[model samples]
Target chain A: MSGTLPSDSACYVYGIVPADAPVPEEVLGVGDPPAPVVPVQHGEVAALVSEIDPRRPLGTPQDLIGHARVLDAVAAGRTPVLPFRFGAVVRDAAAVTDELLAPQQERFLAALEGLEGFAQFTVRGAYRQDRVLREILEQRPDVARLREEIAALPEDASRYQQIRLGELVSEELTARARADADELAARLGPLAAATARADSSADQPVNASFLVAEDSWEEFERAADGLAATWEGRIDLRLLGPLAPYDFASQLVDARGRDSWD
Target chain B: MSVAPRSSNYMSRPSSSGLVDVIDLILDKGLVIDIYIRVSLVGIELLTIDARIVVASVDTYLRFAEAVNRLDITQDRSEGLPQLVNDMQEGGARHKTRGALEGVKEKVTDLIGGDGEEDEEEQEERPRRRTRPARKGREQ
Candidate 1:
């Protein structure tokens, strides 16, 4: 079964890098069938590729992780790469060279240059239930009534009741989180280079990621440290990365290529 | 002034930090050109199906009712109604705290579905049947 795989169906091609990028000759991308990276060069830029099997499904956790690994490997070497979305594929090397690597030459080059010496930072806000509860009790009166209602419930009840109370708490906290987002920004505003807030609904706390300059890593870290100290037990602030600029890439609003997952 | 303020505000937006926020800008918000063939995965539709369980539904209201009843049942000893109400309020505060933690936990579960948030949601909708796994495995 393994021997019968096609040499080329439609391979999902991620972004192109300068030919000098020190990528391994073989790196596997998403799926059970294991897509292999083949380099396709256009002048100075080269694309990192793996075959996209239309038959095989995409966007699984494994596949997404695979996508990140390739970009990370290239990005680590200071290669200015154009990262395709999770499932971007092209017809062949010719298409990659002609369409993406060629037409977008100037933009890609500039972006690569711009991204050098920079890394990404993710900040997730988690409410310290104990502290947040205290704050909520002190801050809101309506919450008092809801508290009274919740107090009257027995310990051993249906899971439905538990979820219902969970929903109310989520709603109230989410409202508070929305209000706090501005304060959060005000507090940590000076710490990051760029930022984006994702809507995680009421159940989840506000989630945001920041892109920080590699040189300013200390400043970013210190700012996060200060906020962590100030907020202390009220909200749990967690940060991840200095890794690839996956969040702030040019692909945020433009499509470089197509893949099966789309 | 507005332009400067907004630009400054935009710059201050954490989306600037490309690392932590990579998940959203690239995957959900980015410009996706349709021509390139993306690998089609089977289970990913489940991810979307799982995302919609964020907040505020009948499931929550019923839980509120039940909690209130349970707290009522626990009222004994020397505590009067007012004192018991006060204690219940404190318990309620604790519950709210638990609920918030539960909210984040629910978010993680919604992402991984390791917990039974899905089954609970389905039970609220369906209400009877007593079966669990059917609701558990309904991947989007």
Candidate 2:
């Protein structure tokens, strides 16, 4: 399997980092055999990769985990890694060096230099469902009156009222969520080097990732905690952090590669 | 390595611990070289769609209506509001969302059937790989 594998092998690329950055030896890469991850260097930048058989499918949850595991390890080790999107596979080692690393060497190096000593943190906040509903009720007397009217009637008798109440509540929830999310951004924006607003879903009003330098991680954590306490019971805030600058690095590289096709 | 003050109202952890957290980071965010191969990820796509089903649906509307309908309008106004809010908060949306979607897995299984089991088994056989910290709230 060893000899046959490398001949037909494609490389699953985990990410790119500076050439001098240390690769975590213990981390495994994606594929059935769990290929040993190694770096392919080109001048100042290096691509972290492992061999895979491209003929096999590569989108299992495990594959995704493996991809993230390698890159996360790199980031945790204080290396500035530009993580590749999951399932980035190349024909072979030559493609890793020739097609990927060679062409993007300068750009990757510059991004890595820019990203040095920084990590990513995601802060997510959601309104306490009950509190928000009550707030809506208090703010909108008509909605409150409608709710009282609907509550007095039987479910079967107030069918139209129920639908109307649902529409009103949904609209109110969305508006409050947007306003709260904006307030969160305004409060947390200055703490980070860069920030990206993530899509807010039904329950969550605020979802954002910040690129923070190593020195300011504590400050960021304190600010996040302060927000959590102030909005306690009203908004549930959680922070995930010291991660590879996924959002920031992706934006940097994606912008440069936008015009280049294949 | 300083820990944020621990509070029940907040949480901090590595993103790799949960399926949803990893999906957000791994799915679309990253550097994409044109030379790389892009496989059709049907499973991840289905999971994403399934996750959104609870957001805006007739089921969600009915649930909201039920909660609102139960509010006793005749009770002492100020005290009743906060108490009702507390009761609703205790019920927790995360659990409700999970419970509401229990049938989704069954439907997904029925749609994918035998092939789905095989895929699930493959995922199970793999080890849980942990590498970095990801901030995810209980609400997400």
Which is the leading candidate under lDDT?
Answer: 2
TM-score of the second chain, cand. 2 = 0.27
Which structure among the candidates has the greatest TM-score?
A: 2
Tens digits of per-residue lDDT for model 2, B7-121: 4334443334333345555566777665333332111111221222123344445556655666554443322123322222212233322321222223333323333334332
lDDT (10s digit) by residue, model 2, range A7-99: 456777889988888888877567766889998988988888887766665554455556777877787678889987776766666667777
For every model in order, the TM-score on chain A comes to 0.75, 0.87
* Model 1 per-residue lDDT tens digits across residues A1-262: 1223344366566666667777744555665566677777777677777766555545543455456656655654545565765566555556666666676666556566666565555666555444554455556666556556555655454454455555565566668777666665666555665666655433235466665655676666667666666666565555654445666665422433211112
Off by over 4 Å in 1: A1-8, A24-28, A150-168, A251-262, B1-26, B29-31, B35-56, B60-140
Q: What is the DockQ of each candidate?
A: 0.09, 0.19
Instruction: Name the regions of candidate 2 deviating beyond 4 angstroms.
Output: A1-8, A254-262, B1-11, B14-17, B35-60, B70-140
Rounded to one decimal, what is candidate 1's iRMSD? 12.0
Show the colliding residue pairs in model 2: A239-B135, A240-B134, A240-B135, B14-B133, B14-B134, B15-B134
lDDT of 1: 0.48
